[model samples]
Target: MANQTPESNQPSNTQTYGFPIYAADWIPEETVRSKIDKDQDNSEDVGGESSSSTSRSCIVLAGGGGEGRSGIKNVIVICRVDLDTKSLAEQPLGRIVLGTDLPYRMAVHPRGGGLVCALPNSCKRFDWESIISPREGDQGGEEGEEVINELKDVGQQLALAFNQEGSVLAAGGEDGTLRIFEWPCMKTLLDESKAHASVKNLTFSESGKFLVSLGGPLCRVWDVNASAAIASLSKEKDEMFAYCRFSVDNAGNEVLYIAANTERGGSIITWDTTTWKRRRSKLMKNYSISAFNVSADGKLLALGNMEGDVLIIDSTKMKTHQLVKKAHLGLVTALTFSPDSRCLVSVSFDSRAKLTVIEKTPEKRKGSKLAGDVVVVRVAIRGFLLFLDGKGDHRQRK
Candidate 1:
């Protein structure tokens, strides 16, 4: 993909840029979706399909924000590209040249007004409005400009999240601590160390009533206001959990889903928020889950794997699971869906981000069921393999 110029109203194709700046080998562990909305000019594709304002999702990338790079350093960039939008997708709307190193972690503010990034021993905030502007501005001088704020120190910060009301910010790091703060102000409210052995993922519930933290072999739930561990979902002293998130439903109840690796393969577990207990744990696939994201509407889930495939799973109906093989040429770093659920944005260690149109899955008539014999056979094979391997979530069948 060719580089895009600094024009927002031009054709969407004319605004996409490829990210070859400060390329690195290891993939970042986080990817976040942006909800900011706007209207833009139209540009018809060669095939006559308009690639204009219908973009529900945009792909953004962060590199060493500035150009010249000595080896690889931690550089944060704010970029947005709509569905069918080009790559590199022009320059990022915002950038931060922090001296932190790789394995970048960032979160888009729930209100879509700001962004927070986490690095080793530090965390910082950036204004989203100015980052997206076509014009560049100085730091802390004007509204929507590059208003960079260094949050209070967070030791070895590994993950960051904003509450649903956008009032609270959470940062989790290597010291097994979870830091909750008032947004913008960055005032520390609760410092809960010993949250885990090492906090790999931290997320707030849709209602901001609960927070979920995932560390290797441990999953703990906490009450937001009380700051106490309310539940522990599932843990294996021998296994490790790589990713976890809250799946919100229409009824406003939230379900906790986590990805873990086993001797058999990679599997997902969903815990009931009401009882703070796991309701289901099932094998999602054989591929190691590297990244996953849920659509805001609570209907869809996207999973990226080590094999570079993105698995689209239906939250309500399990049969709608579809696979996009080799969605990335290398290890996929992050994958996210647009607020409207019509587009998907993915980035990889290949130093590139892509905006892909969502394809409609062919419909299947309701009440259809898998063949009983086929199901039995498949389960028999899997059980035999698990038996040979000596251990698994034995309660599960297929």
Candidate 2:
């Protein structure tokens, strides 16, 4: 979808200034509904609607905050959209809100029905709310009981990745500390103390056994289950590693990858996760790399830079597959792929998130085909990204 214009109040049709900075609240309800419906249709149209298919779900990132002062509320939810008949299949189900007062980051538990969010400035832990039945308007309070509250400081700046089964949640912080937690309990399972800097991004291999943490100049690999540090990768140059991903090969082994920003510009590095062995590293010809993602099948890597542009790389062959410019406006912050791996969703400072559906050619279908089944929902948050998920323990009522 394009940026919205002022007079029209409709998303801007033309890409004027690279990243359009508008209020996320400007996205109208009708537009969200339309985007959801368009995403639900299975026909092969780039931007067309088709017959309704099965129910669809999505993980959304709600982020906004400036420095020591909290400009945006600490409210962020990984919303799970339920689709039916080109319309909302059900009210969007999400976790409890983190409140608007905190500077936080969140991640969808690798497994379904769970999530992890953390405060960047403090040593606060995250809690998990058990799965309860969805109520009218997608409310969860009407049904189940509250679970448990756990606390663990995730140091400055945090990012998380879940194991394949979603059983374990791995959190990395700015202090270069990496912690692993078991689901439900939110108990710390493992902590890697050697990392000295804050972690910017991370991900798990498809096998769920290995975890990769991007520490900019330094990269560390861990065995999530064993909670052991397996290997470390770094660059002699003092480039800040901005993003890192663990892409699995056909053998289920972890292949490490990182995008670093340097004085010269930006570059991407790939290594063997198991051995900390270097595979290939390349400096981006243009566009400063901001964030990147690896497809579940381990075939494609999507990279976004400061220019709101995206570069798709073939991991196995180690080559650039496709490069998309103006992928999003403003600073490209985060990226993720659907379980099926056909669609890529990118969020940016432009105050808008974009869903780029890649039409997988026959050669690209290494795994599931989600292109024809992908749908995009326009997420708009007013005031702040409400974190309470509203399903609080009313029983814990004072």
Candidate 3:
């Protein structure tokens, strides 16, 4: 793919965090609120109405240059996104520098359990309290804090995720081992040594009844209750599976989506959760998808490609609602949607993080509350610019 530059005059709320960001996710709103409440209780000035009612969302980012003596420090940092000001914090609220151990992938618990990061040889869990409330003698008041006692020595996991309810935790190992454990307790639910050639991605269904694992050429769906494989989906032709996610349609029916790339282009293949059969495949032009995520409400699907372009598709129509050309200068490493589904956060190897605000223009016709096909995406980065779609003109958002 050819390198493309965004409009120079367009404003962006982006930040260069020194180190490249490989994994990023929004801290749950409830979690943030809890932290705020805790701080208020400890402070002499007890809040009456709460000063940070409108504070912007916060996200955790983890990545580094590895153990190559590259000077860049391996670290995990929390940053605040100020929507009111349309800017990212110049500095992180908290940071932890790991000398040599690099965090490859991370999953933040949905219900404020904590954060689980994929390290070189094992997956370690970090508590939310420890990260937000730094202690003395700790590096940046965030380092040297021991990982959650239960998650020690879990083995080298390539993917880590917690179900939406935060009751179940799943880990996919580099050696094709898949382990599903009951959260907090760490009781084993399912342990498959040969779940795949190498477990690349793992996602749980909305109901937490099924788990989808993708690696190599196959994607398998496991029955969570039975702790056994229920269905296996294989790639067709030259298609290569990249990411998998579970979402529900407008009618509240469960659907599975798999991001796949082929010689032709990147496409999203939807599957029927009931029969585990292919439902539909939507191609995304010539872009090879590198990162994929669905909004919390299951209304929008976000995709970041190798060319640094970000596309938002309406879940119901599966049509491209908005597209940002050259959203980053390097491969887009990760994409995540805010808990409210109002904003999307994307990070790239360029050491830049951007937040795109979703603005829906709903059309009311004869008592219908359906949103219009057109979605004006206000991308808040270096400068704010509104994009309609691929062919639409870009204009400054007032």
Candidate 4:
């Protein structure tokens, strides 16, 4: 779907990737910065023009036509987002064809080591070096190096996550196995063959001391140091848990947020980390949530519904801060927050991706008596279109 540009706002751009997009994530800022530094060093050695000063970010997208003979190739793509221009590069910076293997899920290492992708029957690792600096004959949108032999035979993972420090890796498999390993070394820390009926979602706490896993109607919190499930969370009547996230409140207390759906609508349920008890439940939408994400700062929450609407909520008030109607033609497949938490990128099965910029509004007082101590804050969300696979046009939406 083409986004309409508003005269008062920056224009949004749209790209169609031809194949369905199942996974998307921002390349770590450290990885991009290191690449820029390496490029500068190479340019200086050859006395070539230096890199552009304009700020840019990179993101990786993975999806394909699966194992069937659909003609379209399974691939991973890297695209650069130009912050100055507020648009994606005309063409992808890199693309890795995966033959018939479809990448269903991915988790990029926080320290720029590489990324691991979940395929049909197993998972594979793709190093950052191979992706950013393709070998000779790897140009012109062709495949890069072969998938790294590491992680081979690791069963089909439905959920993958890395600890905040990137020192630990967690993978939840479709066979109800939960594995946690020391990063890079692959030493097992925890391996449960029956952690759930089928793992669906996983996340690590900020302190890296706890991990949360969601499968079927039960959501489990694991004590990382003990390597055992400490708490088992179950859904209330008619409420189904779809996703879970870890965040910290203003007072620095850890909070667990779960996206849930009921016959009435979609809701955000908060739980206290200390007791693992439901703290509050707020209904956010009338449609089932298809995608959900929490910003790094823990101040904002973003979610997309099956009805193609996106809503940004204030974590403090548990109220809607911004809502974008019909952001996608299909159900949102993934949503991720930028490292700086200033922007959010969302992708859908409709072969479209969007970049939504979050701008904070000036603070306003709610009451005269509380003016000195309390202030109400709101944010404006503006979305830009990102066209991929050489299809579609650019337009801005506010």
lDDT of 1 by residue, 1-398 (tens): 23544554454432223443222111111222232333222212232334444443343345442323544444445554544544324544445344434426777665655555564456555565444444433222234433234334556666777787788887777878877777777676777788878788887887888888887567888887887788886665434687777877666777877777776666667778888776767676466777877777777777777777777777766444667788777676777776667666666765555555567765553323446667888999999997967655544544
**What tens digits encode model 4's per-residue C-alpha lDDT throughout 201-308?**
999999999999999889999999999999999899999999999999888899999999999999899999999999999986477899999999999999988877
lDDT of every predicted structure (CA atoms): 0.61, 0.55, 0.80, 0.79
- State the local distance difference test value for candidate 3: 0.80
Model 3 Cα RMSD, 1 decimal: 12.8
Candidate 2 lDDT score at position 303: 79
Model 2 accuracy (lDDT, Cα) = 0.55
How far residue 71's Cα lies from its native spot in candidate 3, in Å, is: 1.2
Write down the RMSD of all candidates, one decimal each: 14.3, 21.2, 12.8, 14.8
Where does the lowest 10-residue lDDT sum fall in candidate 1?
Answer: 22-31
TM-score of model 2 vs. true structure: 0.66
Deviation from native of the Cα of residue 391 in model 4, angstroms? 78
Question: Cα deviation of 157 in candidate 1 (Å)?
Answer: 1.2
lDDT tens readout by residue for model 2, 169-250: 7767777777778875678888666564677677777677777787746677777777787787767575777777767777
- Per-candidate total of colliding backbone pairs: 9, 23, 9, 10
Candidate with better lDDT, 1 vs 4: 4
Regions of model 2 farther than 4 Å from truth: 1-51, 65-74, 77-98, 120-157, 192-194, 250-253, 361-398
Q: What TM-score does each of the candidates earn?
A: 0.71, 0.66, 0.82, 0.82
